[model samples]
Structures are given as C-alpha cells and as structure tokens.
Target: MDLTLGAVLRRGLLAGLAAGVAAALVALFVVEPVIRDALVVEEARAAAEPAGAHEEELVTRTTQVIGGMLAAVVVALCLAVVLAVVFAAVRHRLPGGTDFGRLGALAAYGFVTVALLPGVKYPANPPAVGDPDTVTTRTLQYFSLIAAAIAVTWLAFAVRNALRRRDWPAPRAVVVSTIAAVTGYVLLLVLWPANPDPIPADIASLLWRFRLASLAELAALWGTLGLTMGLLLTTRRTPATPATAAT
Candidate 1:
C-alpha cells in the first residue's frame, strides 16, 4: 500500500467520520442529558429571581439535542482529519517509524496538546455557567491559550531539531524540548487573566460533572479517531480501497 498524502487523507477522513458517529452516540445518550440537567438548574435559579426574566425559546430542546449531535459529528470528523495529517507529518520525525506504539504515543500527545492543555485553563462550562457579559473576553482568552500552546509545542520541535543538528543526544533533545514547552506553558498561565466569575456552591458539583463530561467528550472523539486511523494506516488493505491507492 502506497502511503501517499492523498491515501493517508482518505483513510483519515473515513476514520474521522467513524469516530464522529461514535462520539455523537455518546454525546446524545450520555453527555447531553447531563448538560440539560445543568441547564435546568440554571433555569430554575433564574426563575427564582426577579419577575419577567427572558423566557423566549428560539431553539427548542428537541432541536438543540438534534443540532448538538450533528455538530459533534461534524467537529469530530474535522478534528480527526487534522490529527491524521499531524500524525503522518510527525511520525517520521519521531524515533519510531510508523509503528503502532509510536502512533498511540502521538495520539496521546495530540490529546494533551489539543485538549487537555488548554482545557485546564479554560474549563468547559454549562450554557449558563459564566457571566453573559464576558463571553467574548472569555472566548478570546481561551483561544489565546490554545494558540500559545500550539506555538510553544512547535517551538519545542524547533528546539529538538536544532539540538539534533548540533550532535545532541536524543534524550537531551527530548528533555530540553519538554522543559521549554512546560516552562512556556506555565508562564502563559500565569500571565493570562483568570475568570473571576465564581461558581455557586450549590451547583458546583453539577458544574464539575458537566466539565468532566465535556473533557470526556473530546477524549472519546480523539481517542477513537486516532486509534482507528492508526490501525487502518498500519494494516494492509487492498489498493482498490481508499485506505490504499495506485502503486
């Protein structure tokens, strides 16, 4: 099987779509209800406040659930595609050469960089969890952290490459890169402004559960997609299949 870029992309897209289906199923059956329950609590809190609160429902609950499922499927597929490209691009640079173990390690790295790193700073919240006035600011800060994480990771790669060119040992290169990335990450967290809106004590548990479920959502999507892509890419398949191409 030729491991051309197009062939890798085809395999990635297929795997990503499969992952999307799995993620959507989990979100629909498990995560969505937890979110809905949190929303209910939020709504009750609002209702108990001053009269004439905004009560219009432009989007119905049925519609929200359906739309959420669809969005999850689409987002999962997209993330899978990106992960596939990243995997293919970086596999050769790493010590292992297209081995399953290396592939799994890369997947874990992706989750840490793409999901967990930024997630720790700007944890996911229920619909009404944060202050409505600070939505834009909060969103900007969250994405800024994501961008910083990505940039730092790239810089670490540059550090490793530079070290490798200078006859540095593999372990030394890895250690330096890890230190640089971690140091940069910590500095960014310190410099970034924190979210001041405090979570109410009563609903803190529910919020925690919602955030956990949110992280689990990404973990499931990426884990499934990465593993599936790795397996499909490593295994032999017919040339007629998208997993392969013309020799």
Candidate 2:
C-alpha cells in the first residue's frame, strides 16, 4: 500500500472519523455526566453568592453539549492530519516491522507526549472549579509541560538513534534511551509548577471522575486511530484483495 501524502491522508481521515466518533461518544455519555454533576455544584455555589454577582450564560447547556461533541471531532481530525503528515515523514525510520506497527507506535508516542504526561501534570477541571484569576497562569503551565514532554521524547529517540549509529546493540540502545526518557520525565514532573488553582474539596469525587473520563476519551481517540488504521492496512493485505502499491 502506498504511504504517499495523499494515500496516508485518506487513510488517516477515515481512521480519524472512527476515532472522533469514539471520543465524542465517550465525551457525551461519560464525561458530560460528570460535567453536569460539577455544574450542579457550581450552581449551588452561585446560589450562595449575592444576586447578580454571577454572570448569565449566553449559550444554553444543550448547545454546549452538542458543541462539545463537534469540537471533539474537529480536534481529532486536526490531530489526524498532523499524524498523517508525520507518519509519511518518519515511516521508514520508525522502529517497527510493519507499517501498522509503526503507526501504532507513533500513536502511542503521541498519547504519551501530547496527552498522558501533560494531563497527569495538569488534570482537566470542570468549568466551575478553578479560580478565574489564575486562568492565564494555568494555561501557560499546561502548555509548558506539554512542550517539555515532547522535547524529552525527541531527545530520547535522538539518543537511541545516536547509539544505534555508533554500533550499539538494539537492546542496549533501547534500554539507555528508555532510562533517559524516564529520568527526564521525572525531572520535569518534579520541576514543573503545580496547578495554581486548588481542586475544590466539596466536589472532589466528581472532579476525579471527570478527570478519569477525560483521559478515557483521549485514550479512546488514539487507540481507535491506531487500531482503525491498522485494520484498514490489514484488510488491504488479505488474500481476497490484491494490493500492489508503492510504499
């Protein structure tokens, strides 16, 4: 099968559709409920405040729910576009025996660098949990951690490649690189500033559930993207379908 820019994009869009739908469903069913629970706490808090102190919402809840689902798809598609282009560039060099394996590895790398590590450092909160004044500080911290994680990943892979180029054994290269990555991540986690806004203890359980659900939705996106693309590739390789295209 061809791994051309066009072909990979076509495949990626299809896979992304599957991924987006999966994530959207998770957001709607799992995360949304948690969000509603948080909103209830928020409403109660607002009720306790002086009248007219709280701002009225311009958008209705139903609209926001539908919009959230749509946003998930848009984000997933955008991320998939990035994945498609990146896979095309690094397809040959990725450490995998097959294209599927390579794509899966890339997706896993993305999940770690782009989603998991950063999320662990700064878990998502419900709309009402944080101090509004610290929004700028929190945003900067979150993106900074994401950048740090990606940099660490790149350096780790670079070190691994350097070792391989120096005639180091594959296992040794992998082990050394893995150690570097773990150490770098640990340092970053320790050094990066914690979320400035404290989690509200009143709704701690709801917050925990919401964070977990958010992670689950993200995991579903990447997992589906990888698996769907792999299945598509596998289908093309079956005996029933003769595939002969440039890779």
Candidate 3:
C-alpha cells in the first residue's frame, strides 16, 4: 500500500487519541481515587486519632477534588480528540508536504494535560521530619521519579518512531532532545519549589501554584520530542536528477 502523509498523520492522530483517552480514564477513575484513599488513610494514621473522627470530612473533600479533576481530564481528552480529528481532516485535504498539523495537535493535547498537573493533588503523608529540609528532599525525590518516568516514556516513543521509519542512522536528535527535556524538568523541580506540606492540607492550594511549573516542564519535554521527530521524519534528501545521475 502506498504511504501518504495523510495516512501517516491519520494513524498518528488515532494512536494519540486512543492513548489519551485511556490515560484519562485510568487517571480519573482508578489511580486518583486509590491515591486519595491511601492519602486519607495515611493522614488519619499520622493524626493519631480514630479514622472515624475525620472519615466523613476526608471522604467528602477527596471526592470533591477527585470529581473536579476527573471532569477536567475528560474535557481535556475530548478537546484533544477533536483537535486530532480536525488535524487529520486538514492534512488529508491538503496533501502537499508532511503534515505538521498532527504534531501541533499532539502538542496542544500534551499542553492541556500538563496544564492540569498543578491541580493534581498529591496525597498527604506525614512529614518524615518536622524540618522543612526533609520535606523538600522528599518532594524532590518523588517529583524526580515521576519526571524521569515521563521522560523515559517520551524517549520510548521517539525510539519507536525511528524504528518504524527504519532510519536508525543515529538518534542524535532523539538523544539531544531527551537530555534537554530531562534537564529542563530537573531545573524546574529545583528552581520552582512547591510547599513541603503533604496532601489535603497543602494539596489544593499548591495545585494552582505548582501546576504551571509542572506544565512548563512537561511542555518542554513534549516540544522537544515532537520537534525532534518532526525534523527527522520531514527532512529527507531529494531524488537525484537525470543529469546528475548520468554524471
């Protein structure tokens, strides 16, 4: 079968849409709730009070936060799907050069998702130490692990794209992009600090403040990955002309 740019972009959009929806569903219904429950349990334990004392309050608050977050994620996913479909249609209609429209759609989706990260409530666990330094360290460590996982996932996609194209000449672009993304994330984590307060006590307030920073970091990673892949896939040598070939 002939491989057209339109077809390629359509596939990419479909893949992205599917993945985005899956992630949203899991994050909304499963992961967030589990984390919230764990956080509540931890909070209750740390308080050295009966869980029943604050069970109702905890449930109500967590439910409200999780509900709002789920709604936001659903909205974002819908927007992403709509944008992707539009991009695919446009690319199909205007078949000329490789479609960067799909890349733009992906970037937009990623941006929206990242933007919501600030609203994500980290479960409140008792601070291991009363000192702010320990809290800071723990926060950094957790965020670092999360950032690393995100970076690794992006790199995996890059590698998969390269493999699909059978253009393993040297993944310099991928390597460079990955390094830049990781660096940006690390810098953001260190320079832009969030409050050391764990969970419900600090979660809601910090969500808005730190959300943008996290989004920026995620945007850097997404931009790096998308741009690198776009560059590699779109830039290719032209076919030799008859005169040049004869020589």
Candidate 4:
C-alpha cells in the first residue's frame, strides 16, 4: 500500500511505452497522410521556383518518418515520467471515485493543459503552411500561452482546495472553480497574440485535417498512458504467500 516512487515509476514507464506505441500508430496512419498531402504543396511550390532557388533537402522522407516516430516515443516517455511524479505526490488529493478515475482525470487534465489549450490557440500546421520568418515569434507565443494556461489551471485548483478547507460544499467549490477557470481561459484567449503567419488557401483547407489528426495522436498518447497505468496499479495479481494488495 506504500505508494513508493520506484513502484509508481516502474508502472509509469511501462504505461509510457504503451502510450508511445499508440501515438506512433495514430501518427503513422492518420497524421502522416495529411502531412504527405501538405508536402505535395511544398513540392509543387519548390518545382515552380527557379532552379537553385529552392532549399536543398538534407533528410529523406523515410528518415524523417522514422525520426518522427522515435520523437513521439521519446516525448511520451518524458510526459509519463512527469505524470508518475505528479501522481506520486498528489494521488490522494486527486478527486475520483477510484484510483482509475483519479488517474484518468489527471490524464485528461494533463491533455488539456499540456496539449489542448496550447493547440487551440496555436493549432498545428504541416509544412508549407507557416512562414519561416515568423517561426520565432510564433514559438514564443505558443509556449507563453501554455505556461499561462497551466498557471490558471493550478490557481483554480488551489481555489477549489481552499474552499473545501473552509467546509464549503464540494459541488459548490467545484462549480465556482470551474467558472473561474473558464473566465481565465477566455481572457487568455482574447489577450494572447494570434499566429503571425497567413495560411495559403490550399493549406487552409488542409489545416483542419492536420490539426484533427494531431489531436488524435495526442489523445491516444495520454489516454493510453492513463489506461495502462491504471491497469498496472489495479489489476489483481496472485501471490504465493498472502501478500496484501493496495488499491
């Protein structure tokens, strides 16, 4: 029943592996095709350029594809480690009917804070869409918004906890917290800088598909990570001796 760091981390790593695989599958089957379609636009633009004007390709598509898959695994592993550490620290405080529910809630929250909010503000774009000149500006805006979103969410949680400590009704506390969080998010959305790059008509049409595919990949990673972590922690295992198990 001891929620030891080692035990939790071990489960987390395995969950991360499963999540990476699931995300990679989504990336390969869903996102990649949309990327390929966008790349066609890039290629056409390049072919239209005067000879020696287009940038030279340093990496082949095959290498990029493989590398992208590897990157997904690496990113998933990092996120899983963070999840494990956070769970170990705050699992008892997390609201849920069961451990599975707690972990699931955490995973869903992680997705919104880490992926959804930032993505909504600055949606993903395939190659040939964004302007190279504005990359730095866009990157800064994207990360800044993510940081702000996380801060807002954390503050909301703290407010809810404070209310609970004051003996406020749980439902009232949650409702108040939710309203505050939504207001904060709306303010952030209105204040944050918009993407500087103008999407070409062709790229704009493809943007919806690319962003949806990206969301699918992200959801797959977080959802699988949660599900796998829960199974690892909760699935009953038979012991030779009567070793006690903890939920």
Task: Provide the lowest-lDDT 10-residue window in model 2.
Answer: 234-243
State the lDDT of candidate 2 residue by residue for 56-158, as single tens digits.
7999999999999999898989888888888888887666557888788788888888889887888988889889899999889989998999899889878
lDDT of candidate 1? 0.78
Q: Model 2 RMSD to the real structure?
A: 2.8
For residues 1-247, write the lDDT of model 4, one tens digit per residue. Answer: 4457887899899999999999999989999999999988888998998899888789999999888888899999999999999988888777665667778877877888879888888889887888989999998999899899889888877788889899998789888988988888889989998999886775667999999999999999999999999888776353556546544
* Stretches of model 4 off by over 4 angstroms after superposition: 236-247
Worst 10 residues of 4 by lDDT: 238-247
89: Cα error in model 3, Å: 13
Residue-by-residue lDDT tens digits, candidate 1, 1-65: 34576777887888788878888888887788888898888788888989888568899988998
**Model 2 misplaced regions, further than 4 Å:** 234-247
Question: On a 0 to 100 scale, what is the lDDT of residue 243 in model 2?
Answer: 51
- For model 1, the stretches where C-alpha displacement exceeds 4 angstroms are 99-102, 167-172, 238-247
**Residue-by-residue lDDT tens digits, candidate 3, 1-247:** 1235554455444444444444445455544544555565558566897555543454575676567455544554454455445444444332123545445534543443343232232323222213455766756645664565455435544553555357543355446544655554455445544646444553454333334433433344345434543443344333454223311
The positional error of residue 24 in candidate 1, measured at the CA in angstroms, is 1.8
